[model samples]
Target: MDAVIIQILNGLDKGGAYALIALGLTLIFGTLGVVNFAHGALFMLGAFVAVSVNGLLSLESVTLDPTKLTPWGTPAEIRTKLAEEWFGTFGTTLIDYSVPVSIVVAIPVMLLIGLIMERGLIQFFYKRPHADQILVTFGLAIVLQEIVKAIFGANSISQSAPASLAGTIDVISGVAYPTWRMVYFFFSLTVIGAVIAFLQFTTFGMVVRAGMADRETVGLLGINIERRFTIVFGLAAIIAGMAGAMYTPILSPDYHLGMDFLVLSFVVVVVGGMGSIPGAVAAGFILGILQSFAAMEAVKQYFPGIDQIIIYLVAIVILLVRPRGLMGRKGVMET
Candidate 1:
């Protein structure tokens, strides 16, 4: 029973990441009507943002101490974090909670990147073929990844959760879970809920939905639907950025981190339906749980290496069973 509960928690934690990434992918598709293969690169950039913030916070100054000598008679060197020297305890706190702090910085940075990408490149592809969209965006993704590799190198950089939340919490009798994972799960829920609320209840969202359904009619109604959709693209980038930033403590990030999650997230997007936000979220959690269960010893004994292929296997089965997915619209992506 405890093991089952633990696995469920693990599933939710993993699902939160999948859902967040998939949600961004769906938003961009629904709003822009453009396939963005570069979306994963945005996720990678977000993780790098966190890494950059931490590096900035930990910036150090080196000084030679004349009073202290090394074994070889050279002066000892003293290294002090500039943040700590300048801000004292607050700086220390900032360093400890860098992951959460990075989210604040990622918002504006990612929004700007999204807007630039949309206006500069994606706008040109609006009337292009899907194959063209895929090719160009894939090329863009490679360029971005190579840039990251050049800057951060190919090694994985580790990030630690805040010391305050680094330990485990008891969820039930004989079941303990890491505090950060729990925080991440709730954080994901909060973000997802906030996005849904913004779309469901806001005037801006209503107009955007109308645009999605009948873009020509909305344009004829004197609404700047194109502008709004551009903002939606920025919003999607922010979502992916937040997910990647928060996930750093859970997964050490490397230059190719975005590529790692790219395919799985695309799978989630497809399974959730081409443009269905609710469907994407649902599929992410469902697949996450199934993958977790498949990784268990009991399940592995019956089916070797099932964990390695569970998500893809389930995606195939789901696509075969429900052509339009669990909550997909009747005409969406239909031939």
Candidate 2:
């Protein structure tokens, strides 16, 4: 029972990320009918945003302290962060909370990137083949990855949550889990709920949904469907960036972080069904849990490498059974 609970929690932790990324992918596919292989790069960029903010907050000013002598009797150099030097405790607070604070920095940056990518590049491929879209976006993803490697170097950048969230808490009398992970899970839920509410409740969301159903009809109704779709693309990028930013504490980000999640996110999207938000969310949690359970010692003993191939295996079976997906509507990817 304890093992089951632990695995379930672990699954949720992993599912949060999967669901978030898959949601954005679904959004782009549903709205633009473009297969964005570069979506993962948006996630990587968000992590870098956290890294950049941390670096900014930790910018150091150095001075020679005549009063403080070194062991060899030479004057010692004092180095202090600019934030600490200028704002004292306030600067310290900023540094401590840099990870969460980066969310603010990532939003506009990601939105702009998304908008630029959609308008400047992706728009050209709207009438092109899916293979062409995939090739271009995949090339873009590689370009983004290389750019990050050049700037930040091919190394992982570490980030941490606020000190208050750095420890573990007991969910039950005998079950303790990392506080940051719990926070991340809840934060993901809030963001997901917010996105869903926006889509399901707002007039804009209704219009977007209608456009998704029949874009030509919506355009004929005097709605600027193209503009709305572009905005939706930007919104999708924001979601991916936010996910990447919040995920830094859990995984130190590398230049290839985007690619690492890209394939899996695609698998999630396929299993969820193309252009289905609810399906994406549901498949994310299901696959996450299945992957978690497959990692168990008992399961591993019976089936070696199950952990690695669990998601793919499930995808194959699901696709075989339900050609669309768990909740997929027909004619989505019909050729």
Candidate 3:
């Protein structure tokens, strides 16, 4: 029982990320009618944000070799000055702060990146076929991944929480667990909550939601639907970026982390319904919990392969019964 409880808690963290990414995908599909294959790249960009923030936060004094430290070839003075300025100005606390601190920087950066992407690239693809969109976005995903690898390198970068967040704590007597994962789980939930609240209550979200229902109709009301969509794209990017930013400590920041979640995010989007916010949230948790539970030794004993595909297996079953999705409309795709 205790083990099952642990897995359930674990699954929620995974599910939270899925829900966030899927929500972004759904927003684009629901509004723009463009099947964005590059959505994963946005997820990747989000993770990369963590890498960037980590780099900045972990700025260190350059170890200059006497051979290169000379004025002729080396900028040793500049490097020394840089390290001191960064640590002194930013405070050395960031040196030991958890990776999740990147969320602060990731949000605005992602939003700006999203806006640029939508206006600069995706806007042109809006009228193209899903195939073209996918091809372009697929290529774009590769390009984005390569860029991340080039900058951050293929090796994963790790960050640890502050000393305050380190070590295990007693959830129960003799049952202490790692503290960072718990912190990540909570941080992710908070992001999800804020996003949901914005979508549920904000005026901009209301407009975006209306556009998602029917852009042509929304346009008829004199709203510049395209501008709203650009913002929505950015919002989605923010969500994914924030997810990746906070996720740095758990899995570390790898160039490939975005691709890892892409397919599952798509599955979550489909399983949740075409444009149903509640459904997306629900499906994310459902799949997350099931996958976590299936990872247990007991479930594996009964169904050997369930551990490998329990989440996807459930997705297939849901699609089989509800071709439109659990809460998807009959023709939301057409609209």
Candidate 1 local lDDT, 1-335, one digit each (tens): 88888889989888999999999988888877888888889989999999999999999999999999999999999999999999999999999999999999999999999999999999899889878998999999999999989999999899999999999999996788999999999999999999999999999999988877778899999999989988999999999999999999999999888887888888888889888999999998988888899999999999999999999988898799988877777776575
Candidate 1 colliding pairs, count: 0
Candidate 3 worst ten-residue window by lDDT: 75-84
Model 1: worst 10 consecutive residues (lDDT sum):
326-335
Residue 179 local lDDT, model 1: 93
lDDT of 2 by residue, 1-335 (tens): 99999888888877888899999999889888999999899999999999999999999999999999999999999999999999999999999999999999999999999999999999999999999999999999999999999999998988989999999999877898999888888888888899999999999999999988888899999999999999999999999998999999999999999998999889999999999999998888888888899999999999999999999999999899987988887778688
Which stretches in model 3 have alpha-carbon errors above 4 Å? 62-90, 172-174
For model 2, the stretches where C-alpha displacement exceeds 4 angstroms are none
- The Cα RMSD of model 1 versus the native structure comes to 1.0
User: How well does candidate 3 score on lDDT at residue 187?
Assistant: 72
| Reference-based TM-score of each model | 0.98, 0.98, 0.88
TM-score of 1: 0.98
lDDT by residue for model 3 over 1-335, one digit each (tens)? 67877888778778877887887888788878777777877877877777776677556565656554565776454354343465574565565563657778888999998888899899999888888998888888888889889887899887666678778776666666678767766776787788778878998888888887777888999999898888888888888888777666667767777777888888998899877777887888888888999998888999998978987888898989987777887677643
Instruction: Report residue 163 deviation for candidate 3 (angstroms).
Output: 2.8
Model 1: lDDT equals 0.90
Query: What lDDT does model 2 reach?
Result: 0.92
